[model samples]
Target: MADSTTPLLSRSNSEAEPETPRLAKQVPSLDDTIERCIGSFGWAQLLQAVLVSLAWVFDAQQTFISVFTDAEPTWHCSRPDDPSCNSSANLCLLPKDAWAWDKPSRTSVLSEWNLACAGPVIAGLPASSFFVGCLAGGLVLATLADSSLGRKNMLVLSCLMMSVTSTLTAFSPNIWVYAALRFVSGFGRATIGTCALVLSTEIVGKRWRGEVGVIGFLLFTFGFLSLPIMAYINRESSWRTLYLWTSVPAIFYCIIIHFAVRESPRWLLVKGRKDEAIETLRTITTRNQSSFRLSVSFSGISIVPETFDGNLYSAIKALVEKKWAFRRLMAVMTVGFGIGMVYYGMPLGVGNLAFNLYLSVTFNALSELPSSLLTFFLIGKLNRRSSLLVFTIISGICSIMCVVVGESRQVLQVAVELVSFFSACTAFSVLLIYTLELFPTCVRNSALSMVRQALVFGGVFSPVLVAAGRKDGFLSYGVFGLVIGCCGLFVVCLPETRGGTLCDTMDEQEYKEIIASNGGDDV
Candidate 1:
């Protein structure tokens, strides 16, 4: 018969084991770890991620609506020699079907429509300005996520602010007011994504991080899927109706998140709220019926590192201080730029293609699901650098194929586009995961924001280039693809980070030693 004290002996032995010998206990098999961590909250987390992403999709839809909405009528004065073409009895001196109606009346109607909708057109300026606000928000507010503000608070605040701004945007009295509100909304939007990413990653164990991270992004794609439905419901209603409708759901989501999502234990521990962190862990472990205990004592959360030295100049100075950090930052920024070019550029470019816009957007959105799944699988099995490089190369090859097919062969062009879309989606999904893994917790948000800013910069330029290409042919898209492809070549230089622990503090010595011994790479 086994003694009751044997349980205590086994526990003590496990605790007393040397670090190297403890490897068996320390490192759980990937599948088992995933089964435990992901199994517990995977579906719920996925739902939450999708909800967050849907907000972005609605924002995208709102941004693009201007391109599709009917242009307002414009008024034009009829020449005395030309027959009066207005339909009103007072203005129409000639028959309604006369040639004058075909020319002058049509022109007047277009002119009148333009004049009527000029205010909304002017309002569209805010949509672009919002990106500028996003850049600022990312640089300033995002860093607060892992600090005193905490992830849950910041996320809730962001959601609330965005919802309020979106609702108010529908009620703006003028274009300037609408634009200002959009700027506010953009600021909120920028902070939420990175904050949520940090929060989600923090809640799970290291082994399941990749799956959870990729699923967060899948939620963003779900948002894209939902946008058209929301737009369709509010199609006949004013643009304001769309904003109002989107805002309503967010209010409820805010409540759900407040009640359901706990503060990240990692963040809590870092902030020295050990009790709260432990309780949070207990809640999770109890729900899953897992015998896991957080090794918080050895986890090292004594000091909270500052992300920036207070001002923009200091942040810049800090970012450039180390060679490795700077190179990694540049690499992520380049990848972000390439992803922005393809993600934003492709949807718009596809609209100009012969395919139906709605069908094409759906296809593009659907393509992301598989890419995300592929990323989840590959990220677990392959080195981060290898996965990124392979996907990018495949995307580039497909993009070049798009140019070869041209518009002459519709089926061929579409097939090529489908391939490009698949590869681009894969590259984009990996980029987010790669960016997250590249930095320590202190600078993670700021680093991600910088990369995101590069992406937005690319997005800003793509539209202008696409517009110009209308006269030159699809040369712009081909060139864009080539540029992205060339950028992918840089992937070879980045360190592979697979199976690596996320750096939670700025321990330069530890980082250097790890790099030196482990081939100087990131996973």
Candidate 2:
């Protein structure tokens, strides 16, 4: 019963109304428009996106490999004179009681390397450092993404840097050296994520932005799924081998991008490089075998407007000026922090439970695929706030159920854990999409980075909680779940954004106002 005329059910009135053409000319065909939008890359560009996401997946997997490595049986041992001993000590001098050696008679020997005790702590350093670097980068250079640096250059730089740093991490001789390389690696990693998003938005036609954004994230999840297979194959290999193998794909991707990708036509037009932008558009039309007719005018397209003085004070002022903006920021920050705690904390916490750690992690990872698929299908059909609320409630219920089906019942515990995995995955997938829609393009990167920073902050404290909880009880993880569920309450305050056109600038605030006046219904 949906109207065909209304493409996006969530669009505000002003947004639904087409803007007057700023340019004097217009493009002639859909083929031309598509071609001009993406340039010479064509279908191959999809591979480039996949490769970039794959590099990130590899980075995440390497960071987590230590967890699996640590759980190996080699890391455990039996005490001397214990009835559990399966063999006599090598130093035993008598045969009367070979299995039960006294302290003096027993010679404790390491059956395997105690890598598990150190691996998680050591491997976690790079992921932590990467997020820290992302926080700093978001605060410092996020604005530059749309202005001077341009999305293409920043993306290429990020990719190359990650490749080199990841490769070096494999060769590090000591833990300190590895950690330092990881910090640099993380800087590049953060740049890739931010820049790829910016680049995708700038290159695509305005009408296709939402679709492209969701697709990019879908590819990111694909990367996440692919990484575990790579790890499973190289499980017995040294950690160095894992890093080395992961970095190779990145190197290839960097080369492909260097040769194939083009600058954003919108970025060029905004920078007053009209001729270059036109030439790029022409190239796209030629490739697509269509005519370009759309007007490309700079008069209407504000070039990084000087709304306020460029300073920290000005940025703070901009965020606080509107009541709705402030509310949105606070809600995003709170939900972001909670989701982060659950997203990163749950897997680590589940692994610590008295179960097969690998199987548990695999189940958790597997559950995310369905969530990602569900988001792809439901995003255009459901309200953002409604979707978020539903998933958060489900995930919360599952968390509470985990407490009920504790170690006392292994089968029930496993089933509840599976439920917990899927619910958390659903919450995370929807959150990423919702956060992107909540902000305008002018400050999108900054807003997203801020939310991501909150998530990282949660991740920072999560390991400690997991470690402490294992030693004490499941109280730590339970607290984490309860906190996240409580945070879901904030989503009720957010406006629905499904099927809405992405807001490119704050000048579009009238659209938001219109949507707000409609009793939270889609325009």
Candidate 3:
């Protein structure tokens, strides 16, 4: 290889000077070489990616089940002896049976628990507590994935915990118990998506990262779409059935994950488990039918940590000490916070829209598919800055338009709301891909979790705003629009990452544009 001081000439100049030998190409780093050895596109890789993404479906199911289970069923005057039952005026004056539920009491939590007339303060408890759990869980357990636990172990544990807690929620005797159980379930839910994303992307070559990530998002949308159907099927049954259906499949999925999936090879190599990494790589190559030899390729490489200490404290220290990393983390998280507020707030706010809850939820869920597909397409073609800028601005404009259209024009309002949601969906997908590209494996899980936590942290305010009702657009649409638009402006600070390789260690990730300026030599 040429020395660092060598003056590199263009291909035409090099050819013209026949006596000058072309500088030997720089030997690829161990991580880059390993990625090439393991083929970029392969059947084995795709199968594993799809399997990991299946978890997102169940994660989505548990997330929005409350929309159906907590819904208020129809009610009417039922008691014949009550004076208001026969009269047409002043139902509150004769409170006896004047607002009796029309369906069986067990149909929904609001109906079964006699919370029909309960104010928003009490009614929104279950759903709101779940997100609170999400925030708490993500903050507390985020580092575990980056530390001793690794990606696979943390993912399996979280899936099992979420499933068990949610199942137990079905047997709750009171709203408090249900809310507590949901909180715990939310805690478990926090890591499932993050781990699935990290593990799936890590298992494959860099070219497939965006596609694999989008698979999880698509599965999530499918899961969201499933809720309304399940609720409709169990409409005559108890709300507990909804919990039962969603939780059971997740429990079974945990078993499959344990038996089928392997730890991330990139993580294994970086953690000094080269033997295990070689074995995993062999499996990948054999499945992909590649000709690369893991033993010969990594013979002289010393795969040691650059600055990371292989623990939570080290991960935090490394990220904070690096100027560029902390800035990237803060910038992306800021954008994530705004996107999260609208992303988490939208479905919950669907009831406030002047439309049927089922249809509105369905419309919003359906919007995710096309938006995700668009993201999948754009991720390959557009740079991170352009994609984030366009999608975030579009979402914000659509949200503002929703407020301008008003509720009186229900069709136009719904149309605009869907457009806002679709744009938000694309923005969120792009954000996830960008975050994955921005951070390295050492703190990838934690950094991604921080971005998610920012989103959930923003979400903590959403329920309160949503509880304010649909009297005006200020609470739901206007706030979502303004915050997302304002926060998205921070994206300009981030560098473009399209067509870049995934950085396995903090040292591998580029910072400060120094490399680009110095003829692409990594410092």
Candidate with the greatest lDDT versus the true structure: 3
TM-scores for all candidates?
0.76, 0.76, 0.90
Query: What's the TM for model 2?
Result: 0.76
Point to the candidate with the largest TM-score.
3
Ranking by lDDT: 3, 1, 2
Counted clashes in each candidate structure:
21, 8, 0
Q: Report the error of model 1 at residue 499, Å.
A: 1.3
- The alpha-carbon deviation from the true structure for residue 325 of candidate 3, after best TM-score superposition, in angstroms, is 0.8
- Candidate 3 lDDT, 29-131, residue by residue in tens: 5445556557675777777788888999999998889888999776677776666466754344556546566678898887788666577767888988999
- The global C-alpha lDDT for each of the candidates, from Candidate 1 onward, is 0.61, 0.58, 0.80
Candidate 1: residue 322 lDDT (0-100): 64
| lDDT for position 86 in model 2 | 41
**Model 3: number of backbone collisions:** 0
Which of the predicted structures, 2 or 3, would earn the higher lDDT when compared with the native?
A: 3
Worst 10 residues of 2 by lDDT: 103-112
